[model samples]
Target: MTEKNPSQKTVSSRQNIRKWLLIISFLLIPVTIFYISPIVAMMGAGKGIVTSAILLYILLFVVSLVVARLWCGWLCPMGAWQEICSPIFKHTVADGWRNWIKYGVTVLLFAMLAFTFISAGGIHAVDPFFGTVNGISITSFQILMIVVIIFLIIFAAAFFTGRRGFCHVLCPIAGLMVAGRKIRNLIGWPALQLDTAAGHCIDCKKCSNECPMGLDVNGMVRQGDMENADCILCASCADACPKGAITYGWKKK
Candidate 1:
């Protein structure tokens, strides 16, 4: 056999590394949000974790721009929850309901964003994870705990039964993040794309099955479409690809 292209192999290895790191991050986000630091320390200066300062949200935007939703894919606790569900539930129409929930959540996030701009508390109130983690009231804490339990159960059930259920259907945060990325598609950072020519996909449907957001990764690749802006970029699709068709790139556009 001819010598392996070292650079190509290196890139593939890096892609695999990022994929696994995203999974690790998924496990870490919730712990960090709840226990470590409600808001992760940014590369730049910042004071309060969740302040009314537009700068904080702006900082989030910059982070998203730089990482291109990799945070959602790898480090979001909620995403991890869904990814856990993927192995539990086989792909089904039930997942369709969960996937559609994002539309309603998308509206909700925009509504909160607008209200927060006016009332200041709107965004904070609707962020379920944030509310659950940092609530001051005992009743609120109980509610958050219940919500967390419900999501956990959903994840566990989905895990045993089939594929992702909660994240694809009920996760408001995933919906919000996807909507934000769609509104600003050019992430201006490194990203992974499914390349058609690689034909690496064996059409095993693992990517679709593994997707916490419940996207049709194989179909999207075959159609030459990457319109599913909600993609977590978890690299589950890339990981499952047998032919190595899915590749990482700074920008496919």
Candidate 2:
């Protein structure tokens, strides 16, 4: 057999690196969730106003303003879990009104936070490690069971709805990121995005097939509309496209 070209090998290597990075992030979730869970933050917020989880969400939103949901692709443990389930259920999500579910969940969550803070008189105290047992998430059997149940729900969403279905339908954090990304787009700020050259496309559907979010990447490329709100800027399409038609780039306006 002939040797693989260097550029193709490079793309493959990058894709593998991305996968490993996501896996590493997934492995770290047992620790990370102690500092990132909205549920925990909300519980703390009910007693006080500021917590590590709230701060983490804020940081993620700020990063999303520049990177457009990169957290969902590169760092989210939930995304990693859903992807790990892809082998058993490689389902495609249909484009429809179901996409509004996340928005509703986000709005409700924000409303709850507002009510809780208002009832508490707002910012009375701060505890970065609130709701966590000495900064550890799995401190008890009950907590471990809760975490397991949460992961099961996320996996079930992916299995039933499609790849990354929880991100598409139920993740309040995704809604927050989408809002930040939209703000960046509206402000014409330089941000991470996909750049496509339709002329180089060979009509192969690899991009769509490889998309973890189940987006219509091939149609987007053919129509020269590569800026998708749902896109996580993962660049899997860029790595999969044999024609080198798609690329990740920083775009202003």
Candidate 1: tens digits of C-alpha lDDT, residues 63-109: 65434456667665555566544544556434345467656864675
Q: Give stretches of model 1 more than 4 Å off.
A: 1-31, 34-61, 65-68, 92-98, 109-150, 153-162, 184-192, 198-214
For lDDT, the strongest prediction is 2
What stretches of model 2 exceed 4 Å from their correct place? 1-6
Superposed by TM-score, candidate 1 places the C-alpha of residue 124 at a distance from the truth, in angstroms, of 14
lDDT string, candidate 2, 1-253, tens digits: 3322236668778778878988997888767776878788788778866888778788988998899888888778888888878887677777887777998898888888888888888878778877766677777889889999999999888788888889888898788899998899889888888988898887778899999898999999999988877888888888888878887878886
User: Alpha carbon lDDT of residue 20, candidate 2?
Assistant: 93
